[model samples]
Target: MTDRHNAFLSDMAEATRLTQSGRLGEATALIQRRLGVPGRSPDGASPADASAGPHAVPRLEGPAARLGTEAAAATAHEALIPERLRENIDQMMQGLRTLAPSLRGLVGGGLHAPKPGGLEPEGVETEGGQFVERSFSNAAGARDYKLFIPSPRSGPRPLLVMLHGCTQSPDDFAAGTRMNALAEEEGIYVVYPRQSSRANAQRCWNWFEPGDQGREMGEAGIVAGLVRAICTEHPIDRSRIYIAGLSAGGAAAANIARAYPDLFAGLGVHSGLAAGCARDLPSALSAMRVGAPGAAEPGGAAGFGAGSVTQNLRVPTIVFHGEGDGTVHPRNADAVLAQAGIDALTPRRERGSSGRHSYTRTRYADETGRVQVEAWSVQGAGHAWLGGSPEGSYTDPSGPDASRAMLDFFLGHSLPGGRG
Candidate 1:
């Protein structure tokens, strides 16, 4: 959305809050941003029929214009709600709430999120010239992946394939997360298989659809194929290979694990849900049925089964989410954890003054108690990558650390067997 539009919504929200909260003067001023004293009722004089005399004049032009301009100033206080003056305020509200953020990058110069430093791979020069932006044709490369590799050493290193969320591109995700530096630091190979608009206008991973979330074919298979191809050329530790993503991408990571339990080593899902629980518009609506803010729609029988991603997922996993997230509910973590059946174990629930909530490092195991599923939670954050670039969406860095945990988790495990 344009800054003007964001400002308009901000005015409406302020006016609504002040009016409801009994602050009429402030409310009036806020509402005036759009209404501007109702344009003087079409009369030449006060309370007269000005249009009848062809001399209708605006009532508060001088002072009211000032009010509109002031109310439109930039502030964190902005909320996308149009004032009552607009006949279609409800329609405007959708843009304010749902569409604005998606347009954030388009409107303003995509500024780096809060602290871009510390979040990226520091002290290292770009390993190879620039990660050659290239693609190859697999079975039917309907979708191609943008590849990024670190200093390509002969020895196989771990591979990290990142999936982009809805309305995002591989380059966008890379620009926001700067994962290339991290790949260089760890000597890891990375692949970002971009989704096409044909699959989704927004280019989302399509993890929300039931048909796309399984191993049958389509995106799921392409992703698997991409991983296999990378493993073939790169020195990726088969057991150590992993996947990670933000929202829909996060859901896809989980879905991939379920479709091919033996392939990936772990997942890093931020602000997303497990596979099966939500697929397609109907199921997505169902998963979001609960009336809680960002809460998971308690699962259905068709959701991830006991031995699926939850049980058979022999790899350890880590999750990061903002406690105050309004997009995807934090409670979905419980549902994702539930699918993994983290029933008996409790990690540690670490927290700080800021809202960062982490799970008690619990292990999901089979009858023998071998570690399988693992997770972490961040508090007081909103839909975002913890300690990620402010340039990205749904990210907050000032809380329980997530970037540190992600790297630690990636380093701790490699493919279970030697290049299995």
Candidate 2:
């Protein structure tokens, strides 16, 4: 393995221990101190925004705090880090400093090979990017995944668990969002869990399939498996871990969040619907308009977080839909909110430019006091990434900086109670 990979694993392993051993607060303090709010990039972008740091992230208090945020540049400095935690994080980051040279990368996913100029692992560095691939087994068989690490100056950095939309590969999703590039600027780690195309046509995850929405058997297990792997293999601050996806991938992501709320700090849904809300495409479409079939009671549609959301967890969420979205109607966004039991609604705030309609966030509170529902309706957007990709389709790069805004939210929330 490359030195960068080795070092990243080491950090994650240590962080995992800290959080699992009930030292989450200490771990957070330790990580924050080491990475120190990431400095600006060579071209002068801005400080690397680590996933979970000192920010006003959404707070979902339950057995374990599991909520995140989408706030802007938060003002946290090295001075705020506790002395003891800083010392430990400093020591851990020192050895990995030498592995920066081996952190290059390759963009695009699925069956396509990385291009000639594409990033080469352990070679041409992109500021600094590090990641790890992992997997697990289920009744459906076995599955694998990837966890991109940001070489933070501070550590125990927050993590972003990215779920790819249907027919989309982790590599393609990474390319379009350039989230890894953003990680360099923000000093946060990015985790990309790929859904096997063999499982569904069009390479879409079985989010609409009931088997995938449950806690034990299908897609939910795969997602939970990835989370478990990350917890076992990295120094991810449990309170700061977040999830996001597009299209069917977005729907899968929402399902994962609602099903495993304890596992995700926050969630971002782009061009997708809530899973198990319907059994098929036709029913899924109908549920998107109103509530799930027979879900007419006040809390009828809000029960998706009972297990699949993450071992019966409740976390913050951010949903994105295009008013003109043809594939998945904008109404689906509402269906997602209702099903997740999110009751708060932020006032309508929108802005339009050129061919884009940008709908702002209206916060909805969940039973745990966390903002359960937050939606971003891109009036003219489509069933694709807001930002464009070189080899990826169904993306609109010219639109709002979805990656940036998503990161802002990712950094905004924290895990309830604390993981370490």
TM-scores of the candidates in the order shown: 0.61, 0.62
Q: Scored by Cα lDDT, where does model 1 land?
A: 0.56
Cα deviation of 79, candidate 2, in Å: 64
Clashes of each: 29, 53
**Tens digits of per-residue lDDT for model 2, 280-356:** 55565565444354342443443443422212234566777767666666666765656555544434444545345
Candidate 2: worst 10 consecutive residues by lDDT? 54-63
RMSD of each: 16.8, 17.9
Looking at model 1, report the run of 10 residues with the lowest lDDT sum: 54-63
Estimate every model's Cα lDDT from 0 to 1. 0.56, 0.57
Q: Which stretches in model 2 have alpha-carbon errors above 4 Å?
A: 1-127, 131-134, 138-140, 280-282, 285-314, 340-342, 345-361, 364-372
Compare the candidates by TM-score and give the number of the best one: 2
Off by over 4 Å in 1: 1-129, 136-141, 289-312, 344-346, 353-372
Which candidate gets the maximum lDDT versus the true structure?
A: 2
